[model samples]
Target: MKFLLTSGGIMNKSIHDALVGMLGKPIADCNALCIPTAMYGHPWVGPGVKAWEFISGKEENPMVNLGWKSVGVLELTALPSIDENRWKPLIQETDVLLVSGGDALYLCHWMRQSGMADLLLSLNAVYVGMSAGSMVMAPNIGEYFVGWTPPDGSDVTLGLVDFSIFPHLDHEMLPGNTLAAAQRWASGMRGPAYAMDDQTAIKVIDGVVEVVSEGHWKLFKP
Candidate 1:
């Protein structure tokens, strides 16, 4: 899986340029499978899809738009409907699973409930993530900073990658707290743990990890 973890929305042209640098070549050739898992706001309908439309250049928005064909749209916030067994086949067909930015905790919860989390780690496709989409893939969602409170009852996620990915490190949160908190969290892990800043990505091919991007990636080992 090739992950593009960015800091917050693609609100600026430079960030968009970075994203385009990674995904532009691949997405430009095929109809991509875009899954905006993070944008789970109430009246959970538009935020996720709209963000993707802008990135894929299927629509116009001031944010990053890459002009890729969006073949599928899955709003994980819609929960149980997305969890059914029938949807697995569809999820399997996509050339790449692109996850857009939103609430990390909420995205994790919805992915767990919908069974998409497990499906993703096991699937044989490119997994692209931005912001919260990046965090949910980690061993823990870093709730202390992201404020991941379950709807009074559930706290579940697939825990796919055994690392705590620091989404948007260059531009989100106080740098000291973000790094210190992340380092503290990584110190306790039994396996490899990483906190990557924006424009940085860790590529995993058949489970072998290699850093690939334009920023810094710090690996913390206890």
Candidate 2:
């Protein structure tokens, strides 16, 4: 039940420390599994093999610096279809699961179909979700931004957490994700929503939620 959800992966010392602390062991002793499946959602261009190259070439990816004994990158979507059993053992052996960002809907597709979403609570490891990774864990993803929409006509609730997370708040790269947009999005929400910038993260452990950040964030309530 340890979750470290961030906009950008480990952007500061606070987030890094929080993640390590959640592990409850020296980070050097732990291992991780990186799932970059979200990168293939809508706007998923090019051949499928190109997507694999992008993930495999992340030798300098940020997930490597968190002090894990090893950070293994495995594109969930690339795995053989209908074979969660083949990868369940690998997932169980890891100390952390780092979900990469791209498109929330795309990520949700692989997680739900792969049965990874159901195995989450039972795993004895930390779940680190960045951007889209954070959104897919919500009970329901309301209309929040221009992209990252859930499937058409489907509630598609992962039910992993009670609230939805709007990541990359005030981030310069995404002009549509301004504070005003977040307010507007939250205004229509059925429940609470959390907005976080790259330097921020929301930590949830055993139902107790905590804000861990080195930048700005907001908790929007309905």
Candidate 3:
């Protein structure tokens, strides 16, 4: 599995290049399987839509521009109501899984409710996350900041990785309080905690993690 988790979309223009560098030219050539969980009802869905189009060579919004196969976008309204069987085809046929940033709590809740949690975790696919998309993949979601709330109860996360992650670290609302909050929150956890500022990313490949881009990343231990 491969991951490109960025600190929000402070520098999205480099995301496609970063992804290509991580996955290599062969895999990068495959269609872009985008999961825009963040902009479900937001007004700025255009960028997410156009990014996929630029990457996959798709002309329309509803179409998937698969270079060899066919590429398409799978818009998820509410995760709880989606059919798992339907995703099998999409997941199996797609080359990459691009997860856009949104509300971390809502995204996690929806993934679990939709029953896509286990399936998504098990797949040996490429994972690309921005902002909230980057946070949900971590163990415990970052402390609520940037208007994204944490899910109630034990809706911690998918635990895809052992660390707790904070995205959009430089946003004014976060600043010093973000890492301080992360340290406090991780006080009882076994794994470490991390925060990546905007325009930065942390790439994990074959169990090895590295911070990419020109920024500072913090890792805290209990």
**lDDT of the candidates, in the order given:** 0.58, 0.77, 0.62
Count of backbone collisions in candidate 2 = 0
Indicate the residue-level lDDT of 109 in model 3. Answer: 68
Separately for all candidates shown, the number of backbone clashes (residues 3 or more apart, or on different chains) is: 5, 0, 3
**Reference-based TM-score of each model:** 0.70, 0.87, 0.71
Ranking 1 against 3 by TM-score, winner: 3
> Which digits, one per residue and each the tens of the lDDT, describe model 1 over residues 1-222?
445444443444554554455444554664465666566532333465666564454542222244455556665656475446656777666556667666677777777777777677667566666666666766665444455477753333446766666555545454563677777766655556677666566655555666655566688765
Candidate with the larger lDDT of 2 and 3: 2
List per-candidate RMSD values in Å: 5.0, 2.8, 5.5
Ranking by TM-score: 2, 3, 1
- Mark the regions of model 1 whose C-alpha exceeds 4 Å error after superposition: 1-25, 41-64, 82-86, 151-156, 172-178, 188-191
How displaced is residue 177 in candidate 1, in Å?
5.4
What RMSD does model 3 have?
A: 5.5
